[model samples]
Target: MNSHHQIIKTSPASLFLFCLLILPLSATCNVEKTVVARCIDQERDALLKFKHHIQSDECGLMDLWGNPGTPDCCTWKGVSCSNPSGHVIGLNLSAAPYQKTCLSISVFSPSLSELKFLKYLDLSSNYFYDMEIPSSIGSLVNLIHLNLSDSGFSGDIPHQLGNLSRLTSLDLSRNDELSAQSLNWLSQLTLLRDINLSGTDLSEATDWTQSIGSLSMLEVLQMDHCQLSTPLTSSSILYANLRIVSLSINYYINSSIFQWLFNNSNYSTVKQSLEYLDLSYNSFQGPIPNEIGNLKFLAYLNLSRNSFSRTVPDAMGNMEFLKYLDLSYNSLSSTIPDEIGNLQSLMYMDLSYNSLSGSIPSTLRFSGALETMHSLSYLDLSHNRLEGFAPGDVEDSHSTSHINSSNQLEGPIPSSVGGSSPLLHLDISYNLLQGSIPSAIGDLHSIVHIDLSYNHLQGPIPSSLGGASSISYLDFSNNYLEGAIPISIANLKYLGYLDLSNNYLRGDIPCKLEITKTPYFAKFTYNNLSGSIPIKLSYLGYNAFEGNPNFHMDKFQGRCDDDKHDGNIYLGLYVSIGLGFYTGFWVFCGTLTLKNSWRHAYFRFLDRIIDKIYVVVAVYLARFRRKSQV
Candidate 1:
């Protein structure tokens, strides 16, 4: 530095730009240390002869093949090679963890069509006991994703898989004895985009919608329980990128297949790439159409158990990215449409066993009055025939957790019922609901199933409902509820199913419910509860302390009788043995049919007596002779 060393110099254009950037980064670190290619020894001996015709590798994936130094079948375990053309494209043997693997379609081998660049094949939930998906897998033909679902494949599906033609996602769902007679060889696969013949058997295909309408690159058409009762004609197969249309448990009673799947002038790109529309348990009846609000990007709309009747359509609140709306077990009557609260991205709304009557729609936070579905979570209007007055205006809906408005609703439960829930299942059972039992529903500390049973609900039972503390199923049965049973619901540590039956509830029974030991269902029967019973609940005998007539139980003494003394001793012992067998069977057949001399002196009685005497003498003599012979 002291000598003014300014003679720095490199030649030929800075040594040719430093050897052209270190010779392509030293040839990309020697091509990134190469190795990721060793698969093809004829596709690793055709996957070791398909794992030596595995008779059952319960998915131990053929013991991960020769792992001593990793004899690389593209590093095994669901092999997928082809870095530098090692070529065994992909073979994911799905069914690990939880599906509990069971591989054995003889390990699906027809020498795996020698992996001619196999393109993704997942043998899902393996156990092909009914085998036959192998028409040599239509010679692979570079398959593009084919998952044989729930494995256990069965016969007839092979029209040589329409010779692959670059299949794009074809899951033969569930398998249930496969079938699919003539889907006209699926119109030669025109690059199908997701076609799951769920629980296949396509009822002899009937050219299955003209071979899925010649799949104009269809998008997810799951034919659930494919006994598909055809009936959607006029096709040009315009599935301009259709998105998830599941004809669940098929028998689509032509609602014109919803105008041929919302055909806004010949399937307007399936209502803008329809998103998850399932015609559940199909026998689809009429009236879901307000043109289904033009499907504006629908998100999971299931017409449950279909027989869809009128009225749910206020143009389905224009969808607004609706999330899971199921018109349950349909017979869909009127009134639920407060435009379904304009679906602020609604989350799970089910009109249960429909006949949906009025009330509960204050902007649809169902009974929470009006939080306007701040992402409502599971609201089921149970067994509907609904009447009014549920709105006590609970405050904070915090994404409601299951509120089932059990039908025939009447007044009074609204004392800020759990203040708008963090609720976990609260069903207003068979309602005519009267008062008292809502100590804010114990402020629903994550309540767990609370059903105000057969209501005409009276007082007591709410020691703040044991502050919920994650209550586990508590029902106030046939409510006319009275006092006592609340020792904070016997200190609830996850109390399991407790029903205060035929309530007029009296005292005792709670002995801290024997210190909260996960009560596997305890019902205080005909409550007027007195004492005795809880010697650790005496193994819930005497039908959980029968009609409490001073409820005793040194092990159910005197068997707790009183529903009018066991219905008057079983109605006077079935009416005194049915009136003493109807008066000795009509007085011995009315004196032998109105006495024809007492029916010929009870007939043969006389003849029989005489014969008996004679026979007796003869038998005595015979017996003596036989004894002697013996």
Candidate 2:
């Protein structure tokens, strides 16, 4: 047996040295843990005081703010603290669902200044009730993001906000009562990357453009509804880094602003850097200048709701990267340039409510013949002067979804519309379109809404339409359509709205089992339909079945016995009655089955009732026989 036992033990001096080396490290770890886990007591008390000043907490934010069990305010909702510093850095109590009662404050809370480390503070969408923006907000000099938009703060905007030298984003929009006499404060925010002052009154701020121009790092500026109708001088500087600019709804009539934005010679910076531009709902008139195409990087362009008249510039085709283009609600005339198909990345293009005339470009069609602009998903040229037939031979339009061109176009709808595209909505109402609706339209598995009313179309409603299980709204009213209403319409599980009034349709109203159980709207008035109207559809009221003399409308007379029937009252009554009968029958049977005493009592009661009925019958029989003998 070769046993080797080498037991070496540490000395007292060595153990003491090891303890000396590990104790300080353990203490440091505890110190760091305390710092990271707990928020400062001063900041927490300040937050509580702020909450106390709020007259309304309808959003229930207070419930999560000061919980006794969780003393750490950092763990509370909408509070973010810094690491190792134990200081509150962010407080976002914005976008709460409460309406006017949200976090109401009559005065700005000075306690907010105690959060010296706050870098982000958002009190947007709250109700402040026309209080002046306090200068104390500037004390939070470390703030990089501040949003007080849509909060009822009136009076002059405090210039002290400019003291936040580190601020990169500032939003003071939707406070219609707020005004700025001078934009000198804005000039001091040199590091600002985004600023939104929409709905604020800045009519007196003549130096608005000059102040904003000074910010070399400014990238996004939105000053819509700011009463900025005054024209900018040609010498006004443009931002080289500006990517997005929205100045809509100010009724700006200055063509000079356009000169400053698109002039290739003087303002080459904005011409090259601007990517998203929105100048809609303004009074800027005259033809859209060809210089707009200078911005090759522009992706979204919205020049709608303006007084701009004349043909759309062909230069628009030069912006190959344009994804969203809306020129609706203008006085634009002339045929749509075929060059629009050059935008390969275009997704949505709307030119409705204009005076544009001529046939729709083949490039915009769902037909696969010219596979131009394959990525287009939505195209709406409705309420225009366009004429001629709609595009046909649609077999490869895999992305076109919405087509609402209610113009003078007259022709048969393409039959292969349902081939590959997942069309979601189709509305060609109030047009001169003739011929029957294509049956292939029913094959669109993703179709949601379809409207083809007020046309000269004539034919029987397609039976295959019931296959569109996702369709929620269908309208074929005021048309020449005839023949029986398809019974297959009952298969639509999601059909919520149906209107086939004023048509020559003649048939029995189909009973939709599921529709009767749920809420739905249907109108079949002025039709030749002759049959007993579905009792369930009576919930839609008498007007829905009026004007059809052949229809047995007596079934709906006195149905609800009151005018309250207009609001689904009768349908609710039927459902309640059905549920009550079902529930009551099961309850009675269950009670008898579950309790032996109840079961015996029920049978005994039945026996006595039967004996009484038998005696009555015997007496009646003897009386009848005696009368016969007499």
Candidate 3:
């Protein structure tokens, strides 16, 4: 009974030891199984076959596949395998790093479909020539992300792609020859979140909007330059949950497309979720719909390069989140709305190349408060017919302002321009602006380009302008600007383009002007500049110094005639020569006509000279004749 009790107690301890040992042993077996679970033999063979079709691999991307010792394809460059199953789940042979490698293949092999477990595939930025995407790719039903963008693929997008129900992102953009005959297959990919078909042909897919709209979870749809002519239907439901929709450069000529897109049943949803909407480079005409403001979440709006006529919608102020607004290259007319000043979050605003008229709204000017577009860094209202005083208090420190061309703005440039704001580029050229360039302009230490050309701006260029050390381009041409070129201008180490032509500028060019550092485009033509040009500036052509009568060009040709009295001397010499000629002609001719003896003597002298010439000619002819006889 004692032995039995002892054995039973020891049994429990022995069993515990046995359990620890067996557990370690089982773990070792599992480790061995994982080691042996390398890439499947069939899948490895498929990869090798696929590599064989690669006509060229400058990056040597396929060197590891079937390489002497490296038999496992999971260890290859762009292959990923599952941890336990060891199935190839990802193949990313994107040519982003090997820019020089032209990875061409005559045919996309069906063997790629052998990677049945593949969930991610990216062959972007590779040159596949004109090979069509194989329909066998549909065999990868587990694929969640497939990107073949800019891969040189052509032909029809296989309808079989719809089989990837789990696909979340599909990017086949920048394939100019790729086409989608029908998008009905896309209706199957209900979980797809993003689709980028930019630069593809979708003109024939008349039901694209309807088919794409059915993807209720779609977040981003980029189809720029897709040849899509069909307008969005009123029933299109694609706007829901769509954060970005880039359909620019399409063939939608009618303006009603906006009405359909913004007035749809899903407008309310789009207003809340939509962030980026690009309909630029199209033929959109008529006024921009006031309903555009309904997209409260919109951040970036680009309607440039269209024929959008009439005033910009005042309702745009409602988009409080709007940061970038570009309405350039359109025919938008009427006064810029004061509502534009309400966009406090606006950073970049471009309304150039339009017929917008009337004075610039005072609200656009800085008020030393945050209620204005205080965040605005770039403001371009160029190439318009706007007339008004220059906005005096534009206090955005880092702003670049351009209000060029045909603006009838009159008055001195706002003195606060360079003094208060850290203005970088200020171009108010090609206008009727009159007044002296404010001396305060020199305070713009950060100014890079300042163009006040082609205006009636008069008065001496402020010596303060030279204080702007960052000035690279300075154009004050075709104006009535007078006075000597400021010596301080020579301090501009970055001065690349300097034009002061067609001005009343006098005095010699600043000797300190670093001609060698001057840009090739430097022009000082058609000015009242006098005195010899500096030898350092002699290399410049005469055209640069033309119309400056007092300026000497002979010095450039190695002559130093700096005679201050040369002009008066030449004038006196010309007068004397004229008088002498007049006296000699009259005296000789009158004396010969009035005195018969003098006339007869003159005739005899002329006859004698004629006879002597005839005799000399006759003698030479006779001598030549005699020589010929000999």
Candidate 4:
């Protein structure tokens, strides 16, 4: 206000300097913006092409990258771009998440080629059938990962795929009648680390062997359900460097190849580096060679559900590093050797469903180390004839008891067994057992499943079992157990399946039957249980109470005509009675026939005599009438 100093302050030189300072940054930002816009437009075009390739009833133009209510192909599900500046780098227009069956490959958008910079592609689990793979797929040079699994793709793999030099992973599994005609080209993609060809039902060209031989640097290869008719190993180059491999569930598959591969007879320089192997559900037979001991690095092995039979090789126990071993459902026989105890690192071992007989090896006792072998979380010895000393059966009673009532083995439930084993599942059913459930079982709180059915077990169910909080499945049926059903069983909250039937036990249903955590979970059924059916048991299926004759249902009525059980017993009873009486009744009628044969000549004589007598009586009556009239 002192001197109205409103002089104009214009600095032309400073303005020019500022503009020069900001020019480079603005140009870089503008460059990025232009690149992003161009990429987005190309992505949209690519999506449109993809939509065109998809069949009707599959995604259409309206639901694809198009505007709402229209078949705009860009705004579709599973469409992604790399960065603002990247082309449509990902496209996942798969049909797995949908259950509709309409599938036509011609509906796929041809504009997908516009995504020239695409790096990832997934068209897995689409309900497509015999759709011709676009030869243009090879043009996606920037693709790093591609998955077309379970798309019902057929025909030969396109050699054009070799053009994807940057690919690191490719999965074309679960196709029908697809052969690896161009798999050799994939070997050239040195960056590829994983390849899955499972369930492809590949042809018998034997080209697959040559193709995989070249992938020296591959880390993981899965060929399960590939319909490879030959043994798995047909290697031209040694897979000594291979890490992870799976070739399971193939018909006519074999471990003979593995046996040959691991042996020095074929490739002396080869030393197997495999850590995991699965040769299950095959017909491989013969002895497990001793050289298998050389696979010291092996941690997991599965030879289950196969036809292999013989004594388990002692060499198996030599691999002290084993964590998992499954030889179940096989024909393996002979006593398990004590050498098994060498696998102190073992966590899981299943020898169930085998023909192995003889005493359970003391090695399983682990010298009272059973409680500390935490890694051994699951052990199944079911459905086998394993005989052994009952827990605490050793000579010295003062010594620490080894065999505990951990299992319901026959002879007797050694009360001491419950003191040692905290086993999760103990099933010793269908054996020549003669014993009562030991009360000591109440001490094993960690138990979850118990099956002592089909044995000679007797005695009341110990009240201690009610404290088994984690129990879920308990079966003591087909035994001699007696006494009233214990009420303590009500404390089992986690119980989902309980079968105490086919025994002599009689009692009123425990009131807690209504208090199951799951209302209709399961019930005490098929037992000698009487005193009215538990009302809550109405929730169970009708078949659940089949063997319990006294059980009744208030609403039960006759079943439909087709129901097999409909009046079947009554009808069978009538037929049996009729058949049983027919022979005797017919034999009595034969007696009458013999009577006629014995005195057949007197029939007319008896008739004559009877006529004479009748005539005399008539004459007398006539005379008497005449006299009365006179």
Ranking by TM-score: 3, 2, 4, 1
Instruction: Estimate TM-scores for all models.
Output: 0.36, 0.78, 0.79, 0.68
How well does model 3 score by local distance difference test? 0.82
Clashing pairs in 3: none
Model 2 C-alpha lDDT per residue in residues 218-291, reported as the tens digit of each score: 89989988998566666667768899988888886455678778652436777677889988888878899988
Please, what is the whole-model Cα lDDT of each candidate in the order they appear?
A: 0.76, 0.82, 0.82, 0.66
- Per-structure clash totals for the candidates: 0, 0, 0, 31
Tens digits of lDDT, candidate 1, 94-180: 884546766766546688888888899887887877877888889888899988888788888888889999888888888788886
TM-score: model 1 vs. ground truth? 0.36
Model 2 TM-score on a 0 to 1 scale: 0.78
- Between prediction 1 and prediction 2, which has the larger lDDT? 2
Report the C-alpha lDDT of model 4 over 504-603, residue by residue, as the tens digit: 7776666555435453455456667656545555577666656666656444333333344557978999999998899788777676567875435455
lDDT value, residue 102 of candidate 4 = 37
What is candidate 4's CA lDDT for residue 75?
A: 38
* CA-RMSD of model 4: 22.7
By summed lDDT, which 10 consecutive residues of candidate 4 come out lowest? 394-403
**Tens digit of per-residue lDDT, candidate 3, span 1-630:** 795454345555564565466785655333122134588998999988888888888777777878889988899989999977889999999887777644677778789888889999998888888778888988899999999999889999999999999999999999889998899999999999999999999989998978887898999989999989788766677457889989899957357667656767877777799899898999888889998987887899999999999998999989999999999999999999888878888888889999999988766543332247677777788888888765465444546554455576767787667654567888888888888998888988888889999899999999988889888888999999999998788888787788899999998887556543455567888899887766656777777788887888676422323443676788899999999999999999999999999999999999999999999999999999999999
Alpha carbon lDDT at 122, candidate 3: 91
Report model 3's TM-score to 2 decimal places: 0.79
